[model samples]
Target: MTTIEIDHTSRWFGNVVAVNDVSMTVGPGVTGLLGPNGAGKSTLINMMAGFLAPSTGKVTLDGKQIWRNEAVYRAIGIVPEREGMYDFLTGREFVVANAELHGLDAAAAGRALATVEMEYAQDRKIATYSKGMRQRVKMASALVHDPSVLLLDEPFNGMDPRQRMQLMELLRRMGAEGRTVLFSSHILEEVEQLASHIEVVVAGRHAASGDFRRIRRLMTDRPHRYTVRSSDDRALAAALIADPSTAGIEVDTTEGALLIQAVDFGRFTALLPQVARAHGIRLLTVSPSDESLESVFSYLVAA
Candidate 1:
């Protein structure tokens, strides 16, 4: 449908630089823009949606500029992260107004509501709707135009599990239809399950961009440090320390567990169970100390 390009773009706010000189391309398919809190992800999404301007570079849809460009709306539909949508209007009324803004009528509005499966509650006032309901209504308003590019910022912030799955499926279907769909999130599992492609950001800087598997491997390639408790700590540590895949290991006397720094994630994982079974050690608990996304992301960004 539409391709978006960000070229050496930078934005600032007085003394705080919001977005550094970063560049990337977002094309047809679901792309998860991932970053920690206050990492300028929302600022980047706003620029792409024509709601904000880059102070030092260009954000374009295909070849057309996205900033100060009202004509781009015909091809761009945005579901913003800000939770300030109209609360007085009913669902149907809100969607109808969105259609009217795009020079369409109520029929198109109704279809949009149906597409989001919100027709059943279309008559209810938005003021009484739940967070998830409000999210879906906002999605319907954005979909009313059937634009080529769809941009969503933190779209699943307050949604329940079922609502999250439904929205993910809808976005996947839209991407399959050749519509470019991009959403931002800080949750690693959400990005992993929803978007195969990922772009990671940290502290207003672009960290990594590629398939999720590559990123996952980069994060997992270093020694996977884990604390394990088993029936035989001494025996297990002795056996594991002999293996070349295990760089270092220590038996924690206070915690009564073994600290293992595994060099090869895949090899260590497979060797663990086999060694335990062969040595007749019943494992109590195995936990990775550095498995959190925050640490991984920080490492990637620092690199």
Candidate 2:
């Protein structure tokens, strides 16, 4: 398996800079390209798949340029976000066409179809397939050549949990075989569950790149605000403020609750309950105030 490298790359469209000075190496393993919507993940994937060229620097696979290099397709397989596969062709025929493009025969198509478990409906035209079915068919096309490097863009979109799990298992296996697998996603849990390493992009800029847990810890270190209502609000706030983990605690007059800003998320979570128990305060509600994905993503972008 070969590693893909992006060195000082930047892409732009007239006034819009899609990817700005982002460089990273993706090697053998399942890597999650994490980003919010409109974060240029798609643009980066396209460049890696040789679908687009950067305005500056280079994208290479084992030191060979990827852009406009037809030979690179022999080593790379791509599943793009756009759903423009041959709809008139049957599932089997579609895969057969893909195999034929790789100079293989119908048997190669059948094997790829079987791997994705789409043989049952392989005879049906792709026009009748649902989004998830189309996804599996697209996956079959990418796998038909058994390429070492696989690039997928939002591969889990519109998939059910079972379908999602199946795809995840397949990717994990490919990664174990030393194939470089990179997929883009906006969801945190998908990346957290499937990838040990992650690269985060924000506002068309490379934000963070490394282990998922390390990036996660950086996010978790941000203040975690929560709203809590207890039997004795003042007493609970007093006890919570005594701990260094609690950055700031405010007693809301109209809301009749405590607004807590926790600098240390993990420590504060544990500290809050313990403080309540020890102070003999009964908690009526303990809801996280800033648990939305947008907030988490914005924080990463800001950082």
Candidate 3:
């Protein structure tokens, strides 16, 4: 099985460091690179794809260095996040061109298009396709060479629900076949649905690495912040503060809402409605303020 290893790796753009001293091993099966924007995920992926060299340490595929190695491209396929594809070409022509670059033929291009379920629109110009169609065509081009390792950077950018599910199934099957599949995503739900193993990066540092459930528990166990609005704000806050689940409560006079921090997510969620009803406070709005992946990454970094 193909494996990519990053050992004590760091990438810097002159004075700015994009990736810090981080290390990880990506083997067979699907692994999700979980990180917020500008968290060095793209930089790390670039090094693995041999598009960018690490400033320090090494990034290798198997036992060979990946930097400046053109031979490694035979074993690695990359679906970049950016939309730099040729809009003038049809889907079939674009995939055929990618196959040709790898010394492949029309048969290889056809198989790749079929794998991504893009054959129906293969004759259509890329400019005429939707966002989801464009993504599928990009995926087809990457799979044209049938590489052992696949690296997808934000592969589900603008896909609809159906298209997203289709891609997930394709990746799942690829992983089951023992190909090393690594996809970077900031969306928790996307990663949770696709990858059981995840590596989290925060502020250019490796924050956590393990099973998704374990890391998810770590994130959820922390105090959750929420913005709560009710008819009787003072009464609701007072009632919620008295509960053991609530750690703190702040009255936001400017927003006319209560900022609450809950220690026990499950207990607090159940307690909120009960307390509001007891105090005869009509709940107007109750929304999580720190549910974003950035917030979760920040908590991991602080820990």
Clashes of each: 0, 0, 0
Q: For model 3, how does the per-residue alpha-carbon lDDT over 200-281 read when each residue is reduced to its tens digit?
A: 9988999999999998888888999999999999989888888899999999999999999999999999999999888788
| Better-scoring candidate (TM-score), 1 or 3 | 3
Better of 2 and 3 by TM-score: 3
Off by over 4 Å in 1: none
Q: How do all models score by TM-score?
A: 0.92, 0.93, 0.94
Model 3 Cα displacement at 78 (Å)?
A: 0.8
Local distance difference test scores for all models: 0.91, 0.93, 0.94
Q: How close is candidate 3 to the true structure, as a TM-score?
A: 0.94
Overall local distance difference test of candidate 2: 0.93
lDDT (Cα, 0-100) at 167 in candidate 3: 96
Q: For residues 1-303, could you state the per-residue lDDT of candidate 1 as single tens digits? A: 689999999989898998999899999999999988888899999999988999999999998998999999999889987778788999999999999999999999998999899999999999999888899999999999898999999999989999999999999999889999999999878988888789888888889999998887887777689999999999999888878889999999999999999999999998998899999999998999988767778878765
Candidate 3 collision pairs: none
